[model samples]
Target: MGTRRPNALQWVWYTFGGKLPAHLSEWVLHDVTCRTWVLRHFLRALTQLAPFCVVVLLLPGPLHIRLSSIVLGLLVGLFYSASAMVETNEHRLIKHGYPPGIGRETRAIYRDLRRTARDEARRRRGWE
Candidate 1:
């Protein structure tokens, strides 16, 4: 829905800006491949918008937080959530490589990471 293929520089910027490491580029790539950009946007928007809505609804004062704030919050939250989700999913994928049950996958990925740093190291060395 937005841009595609965020470079490493972009990732660094996002990370520095407090993102949890969700790679929008990779999510976009996967979504585009699956022809699910609309769904991806919708979900990401909903996730991001949820918090803003809560803030707006729960505001103790009159609903005068500025339309700009609301809109900006929505946009920023969406991007942040999308990025976070991408990062979390990538971590899972790196650890588990796609299997059933997220809990199982998460544990597997964690266990693998603990035991397989050498493998990753070897791969990195090969590229050097």
Candidate 2:
């Protein structure tokens, strides 16, 4: 199936840690890598927070309150973007042709490789 762009509500759900259905996950992963996924979320958060930042600065408020609002907006934006990490990783895995739940297997394989390399190094040092 062609990838359907997520609507606002779906985006909100995804931002809040909702899992995409498998079919959609594959389609989304086809379009986005880990870097683009992160940039997309960051841009989205900035887009949402920009207006709030402007309003906070423009509104008639004490200096401290305005500063606090700006800070709070930044914190909230970062939190919202970071909350999508799970979905981002899922998409990244699919993009790389790995099925869901392969992370542990991949890590184990990586660890084995590292161990073998280390053992080979030790053996070579012993010979020398």
**Best prediction by TM-score:** 2
Alpha carbon lDDT of each predicted model: 0.53, 0.65
Give one digit per residue, the lDDT tens place, for model 2 in 18-124. 65555566545533443254576676567667778998899997989999989987998779668965566555565545788554454456668879999999999
Q: Can you give the lDDT of residue 35 in candidate 1? A: 35
What's the count of clashing pairs in each model shown?
3, 0
Give the number of the best model, judged by lDDT: 2
* lDDT at position 12, candidate 1: 42
Q: After superposition, how far is residue 111 of candidate 1 from its true place, in Å?
A: 33
Estimate TM-scores for all models: 0.35, 0.41
Residue-level error in angstroms, candidate 1, position 18: 20
Task: Compute the lDDT of residue 69 as modeled in candidate 2.
Answer: 83
